[model samples]
Target: MSIIQQMNSKLANMIAAGEVVDRPASVVKELVENSIDAKATNIMIEVIDMGMGSIIVTDNGMGMDFLDAHLAFDRHATSKIMDESDLGHIMTLGFRGEALAAIASVSKVTLKTRQENTEGIEVIYHGGIFVKDGTSTLNQGTVVEISDLFYNTPARFKYIKSDLAERQAIIDIFDRLALAHPNIRLTLVMDNKTIKSTYGTNDFYSLIDQIYGSKMTNGMTIFEQTVQKIHITGYLLSPQIARSRKKDISVFVNGRYIKNYKLVQAVIDGYHSFMMVGKYPIALIHLEIDPSLLDVNVHPQKYEVKFVNESILAYYIETYVKEALLKQTHQIPETLKNISKGLDETYIPLNLNFGEAVISESKPVYETQNTEKTPKLPDLEFVGIFSGTYILFQNEEGLYLMDQHAAAERIRYEHYFNSLAHPNPAVKHLLFPHHLQLTSDDISVISNHPKKMNAVGFYFNEQNDLVGLPIWLNDSEVEIAIEAMVSMIVEKDAIDLAILRDKLAKDISCKGAIKANKALSLSEINSIVKNLRACENPYTCPHGRPTLIKLSHHDIERMFKRVV
Candidate 1:
């Protein structure tokens, strides 16, 4: 007998399952994509025992006819594409046609489907083999129920993750699919309880709010930008509510969620100066590009894609995100931060609290949208300084408490940031020569970018000593400013002024700002408040920390139970 022989269809499909159906989430993703490709406006996915026990997907989409109802279970059988020419321009989500076959190879499947004004049919398959076919009395659409997954291939169970892990994985996938198509009403149920729901509402932000939970969209802003052939819409949350993980940054391409690190990083880079180190913002980027420039067939599961010019696309995304964020003014939200961050890591209990997100067969809550923006700071009267940290201020609307250190940082940061970007600057003559102490590495890093240093108004002498300082720099902070500039140059490992400016601004602002537990005279306190109000983004420091918080008179009364 020949050592190498053709494998049977059952074995082939089972082997293909290794790639297409790695976990319960994989099954959910494939089934949901199929439903979406079927033009299903409403889809429901139900799972039991973390999907190891059973999985059912029902959709009110265009169902297959009697012939396709049976053939859909065959490997490589597809109605999505007719010939090889269609491979280059795949618009449907299930073009490969291996999902049903691979899913059936290791489990028992029952499929009921019907077309408009046609008789319904039900088909059964076990281990990729057809067992029986019968007439069905179901409505227009298709229903797929999978039981005993990986039953034939018992060893596959060993590769499965834990129950909680699998549940999160399934929910993550469901979230992505629902996020990609907001016009479709999608629901996910686990153990008879609804996990998520969206009701064919085209309001992207409301859908995002529904999926992510109430108050999650508190600091988010939406904007759209278009290139020659590509248009990107961004929904970016403020850096004040930054998260520690990359999972919250979602990117979609033509209604398909894809994984592209370069693009995700671009979104982060746009927030270079706004966010603290090690923190990331939650955002959704939708890239609508010509299909001819996109290659989605790169990854086996189609999670990643190849763009014609990935770098250019990333640049646009970063620029647009930065512009959108810069256009908005923010104030410290007194109740939003503590409540939002206090929730569980994963979204939950939203169906009860969010009347706008989760709903029944009624009118959309966001049908008439009410817009809200972070209000501008009002002119405040200096009450007093408390603990040498918080400066108290009051206006007719509310009471304001400002962090003296953070407020100072924001004021100085804008000054240095603008000075660095200026083409021409005035250098301040030092009354006495200030000697600079720098390691050889620091000198070398600064030496490589002499022009950049001069452009920012920091020049060094032949002995590696400072000659003069920028007019914007206070004489008291001469040594500290040079040290800050050098550290940024070394940390960034390059002389790029655009990147160096932000780092230097952060370092200089924080290092020179007044410290806590220090005394400030009434005049000094008023000066700080006046300067802070002049800043472009006075609400936050350079490192994205809130500089001020508001407490309404009603809030104080409620806290004391006097308002009730």
Candidate 2:
């Protein structure tokens, strides 16, 4: 007898289950994809016993007949692909035909399906064995109930994550699928509570509003870019609305969700200089390309894909997203109709002397202190300050409110950043060499990186005390600046000179900028505004809070009911 023998069907199925049904989320993914492939307009997923106990997926789609339903549990039985040639051009979300079989092998499965013009049938399976069959009077759709996941395989069941973790995985998959298929009415319920739901409006903006909330609509813009037959379309959020994680960033290819780091990076790179450190913007990117140009069969779970023309895809995505962001900057945002309802502009308290303001029932106006305007200053005429924090101005385009502190920070950050980048540091000899005390770790870091200290214009004495300092910094500020750079290295526990220099610049700028509640004269405010306009990215501070907010005159009129 030959040493090698073919594995039995049950054994083969159990082996395949390792790939298809790793946890509750994997089973949900396979079944949901099957429903999507069946042309389902509406789908509902219900998780019970925190995902380890059971899962139910119901769909209003063209169901399978009795024979096809039975074969659905058999290995290598599929109606998606006919032969080998169909592999290159895969259109459906699922085609492997192993999901149902592999899933059934590990759990108790009950499937009830009724196709059009056919009687309904209910089939049950336990641990990959055909248990029984029954007749049912059901609608023309499918209902799949999977219970006791990993029951037959205790080893695999032990590796499953906690209930909360498993529930999160299921929610993640459901969100991805719902985002990918905005036209489908998707609902998800966990432990008797509906967790997620979307209408079948075929409008992605509406879907986003439903999921993230209506206020998020203010921070996002839609864009569509085409190259020949391929089309890239989606919504990209403003940098101000970015979050710390890339969790909100989603990518879809021809209505199928995928995980592609290069594509995600391309979207991030589009923000370029506008983004803050370690932050990612909200992006929902959809790419419509020829199915022949992509390979969706690369991954067992069908979440990863290989593209034939990824470079071209990345180029268009980066280019169009940048263009969209630029366009958004120039366009006026839609105004809320009742924005100024409770705000009384005419009321000026008796004790207040808010610079050069003439309050009237019609409209309030403020005169600028400087009659002669310079080119560097913005064309906007100066209005009074609001609460001593924001400087108000009016131009032909709109009403502008500049946060004094944030504006000054942007100007200061650029100044220090440029000086640090091009280190022509002017040094000053100390009248009395200051003795510096530091922790052993800081001393070791300084000792290891003598060149970094010299590059930042710090010269030490024989005892590692501060002897000389940068001329741009005052004697009083030297200790603070040096400590900032040293503490940054110590905190990170690393020695990247470039990052240390940048952090030092940012810290110095933030410390030196003017703070809120400090009274500023009209000329001082104008000077800050002029310097802010000269900055490369004046819209936001180094920490990414917007420096200014604009309210268009049209928006003001709408709020006052002057415009219908």
Candidate 3:
């Protein structure tokens, strides 16, 4: 007998099930994705015992005819694709044709479907065997019911997670699918009770509120950016609502949920100065790209995708995210908004002395609903410093308190960032060869990508010794800058000059900013205020700390007995 024997169709399907329907959530994902591809505007998913006991999916979508209804359980049977060219342009979610077969092989399945101009039909399958077929008096749609998951293959049940874990996993899939297609109404029912529901509507803001909470939309903002053919729409929540895990940082490409580290990191990078340490913002980034530019067949579950020119796409996403955050900076440090809202801004409190009026010559960028490009800062009269820290000022709209150190950091960060971006390299000879001792791993990393340092205007000899300095870097900060660069490269093997430049800028600016409890001359105050006002984003420093806050004139009156 030949050692290599072809497995039976049922055995083959059971093998394939290991990849497609490994968990309750995977089965739910496939069934729901099919409904989405079928042009379903309404989908309902009901699961019992965390989907191990039974799983039911009903959709008001284009139903399969008698032929497709039967073949749907056969391996490699699909309506999504036909030939090789179809692979390049895969707009549908379930193209592989493996899900139904794989799922049916492991469990009992009942499918009832009725296509247009066709009579209703029902079919049943047990462990990949066609048990029966019959007529049905059903509506014009499809309903698939799966029961006794992993019943035939009892060994697979050992890998099943706890009921709570499986339930949460299914819920995560529901959330992803709901977000991907907000126009579709999706409901999840577990153990005879409704868990989540999204009413079919185009109002994504409302949909998000339904999924997250009623007040979620309050902290979230929408932003749009387009470059060439690629368009991205980002819904970024304020950092205050950020979660500990990167799970909430979801990304969708061509309306399909995908896992792209570069794209997700781009959004995080855009939130660089706006996010506190050890926290990731809750963000939903959707990318609309030409199907030809995307390779969706890379993963079995179709979560990981490859995009041509992904770096360019990431760059645009990062830039626009930063732009949107800068435009909405006043909303951060949240206490400022909580105090001002529903309060009378028209009232000017009594018994308060605001010092001499200081008019800023340059405009400052403040939060506004206006479409104009230039951001405007409030007009304030300079008041004396408080507690040797806050730079106080008063305007008709409110009382302004500026964190002097934070303001300086923002100003200097922008300065260094701009210089790094446009390096006007005035190379000078070093008094001594600036030598950097590197570990073997560091040397290997440097040798692997020798251009990363040189691109930033740091030249090294064969021994990895720095020989020249860029004019933008001061002599005093040379050791600090070089040490930081080597550490970054050694730790993560960072190769991008842009990222390196940003890291250097953040570090250098923090080191150079003025310390607190120090008095300033009148001219120094004017200069600091002027430079800060001119910055692209002056509301927060590189570390996401607020540089200034505003308290309206009415806030003062409410504090005293002047007004209630």
Candidate 4:
């Protein structure tokens, strides 16, 4: 084999670009992060052709001088840190310093910057080649324009999404940045249209209201705690406003947004009993700790961080969240605003043991049933109770048993399930508006699926961070029901009306049904029997558990040695 040689600088940069710059979104993240690291208070981002033709980011921060600009394109050159010691306590956003060089290697890049006190200068590079040296320009802030991205690397260009998808990715990055720093003003313009413009007023709550709506803002509960070198602060949704998805959970370390599953799971565990099975609560958490305890350089992109005391941190977060939820009462108020959108579109039916029986709006239809039309059973005989839950009966050729509670649950489950499938006219009016707390991440998830919620039998007003619940839930057990439903919604991305209805029915039955030891009157027993006989699966409940069991006379005789 021939001896191998070192790869060219341009080729090496292209490889680095593969790690830091995957799509238009990756480019946006790196550039925006640089702006943040420079302590930019005001940032404006513009994208053309969905970031395919060009992407521009302008920041009013501490810009670089001519020499700094030249060194900025060299790998491993960063103003944020010096050596390994600085790795433990990183406060700046862009530390790797490879972003600019990697990005320039695959695209046409023009970087123009001027220190607050120095004259502006510009440098242009095309496909890793320096075409134009430092030239006098006319600006105080830094303006980076990247054009024809992936030009040198044709293979990378093919993976770019459609214009709309790419545009959305840009918006997502912009939103995350804006959420992380509510004190900074941010502007995002796509194809000459402004999608978001925020004033740097330093009001985190108001900013949340603006982005997620007042409904969510109002429902949030402020969460603050300090434990053993870790200080946590953020907002959490009330139990009544729980979600089924983790999209609403946001975690930030120092000021950097991070994706830590352990931290997020800790938050979930904190709200465990407060929510129903399979539901998640919305949270926006910011953690402040000594940088020496964490490592942010684990990945090339730096979206994730590893903490030295990860287990301890998780325990603290979980305990904090749980205590906070328990200490507060999240009951729905009686004076909520009515914001029902109607049930015409949202409804699905689950096929169970019950059948739909229409009820007349006028007089009772059962009262006018013809006396002669009803047929009687020929020679049916009543038998004693078998198991405590079932009633036994006997006939000439068959023996039958029925479960009272199971029959009731099946009837209720089927009724609600079918109603959800084709929702009838719903009487909806909010009794009291509820404020939902959510993290910035949760807000992103909810914002993406407004139509899905509306398609279900429930409608909410996305104003003021407070979601207006359906009026039908007014008299119901408010907190538990809402939490359960939200949990279900989070588990299932879309709203399936039938599943929701069935869940609601199960919850209600579990809470309101008669217990096993309760005594029943003869009339009540007769009524239960009639209902059981009418049901399709009279021996089992909605949960698929057998409601009744029968032992024939022959089996009883064999046990007693009468038929041996």
Q: Considering every candidate listed, which one attains the maximal TM-score? A: 4
The candidate that wins on lDDT is 3
C-alpha RMSD by candidate, in order: 24.2, 19.5, 21.1, 9.5
Per-residue lDDT of model 4, residues 1-564, tens digit only:
889989988888889889998898888888988988888899888988878889999999899989998898887889999998888789888888899998899899999998977888899999878888666665577899999999888888988765545655676677667778888888888789776777879777777665544566665667788877889986776654555457567888887878899999998988775653345766778899889888999888888998888889899888888777555644422111000111122211111222223222232212433435543222335676654445566776456565555656655544454445555436354566554454333444445556554454344465523344443343443444444454454455545666777776666444334212244445455545554444444456667867555557787777889997
Error of 4 at 71 (Å): 2.1
**Candidate 1: where is the Cα deviation over 4 Å?**
331-564
Of models 2 and 3, which has the larger lDDT?
A: 3
Cα-based TM-score, every candidate: 0.61, 0.61, 0.61, 0.67
Clashes of 2: 0
Summarize candidate 1's per-residue lDDT along 420-459 as a digit string, tens digits.
6754568976665676533332454456567767876877
- Name the lDDT value of residue 246 in candidate 4: 70
Query: Model 2, range 76-118, lDDT digits (tens) per residue?
Result: 8899999988988888988888999999999999999999999
Q: Candidate 4, 113: how far from true, in Å?
A: 0.8
Pairs that collide in candidate 2 are none
Task: Check candidate 3 and list the clashing pairs.
Answer: 364-376, 364-377, 365-375
Per-residue lDDT of candidate 3, residues 338-433 (tens digit): 212212332111110111111233432222323355454667789887755577998788789987767777777776676677544566567677
Q: Which ten contiguous residues of candidate 1 have the minimum total lDDT?
A: 346-355
Model 2 lDDT at residue 237: 66
Which ranges of candidate 4 are over 4 A from the true structure?
134-138, 162-165, 330-564
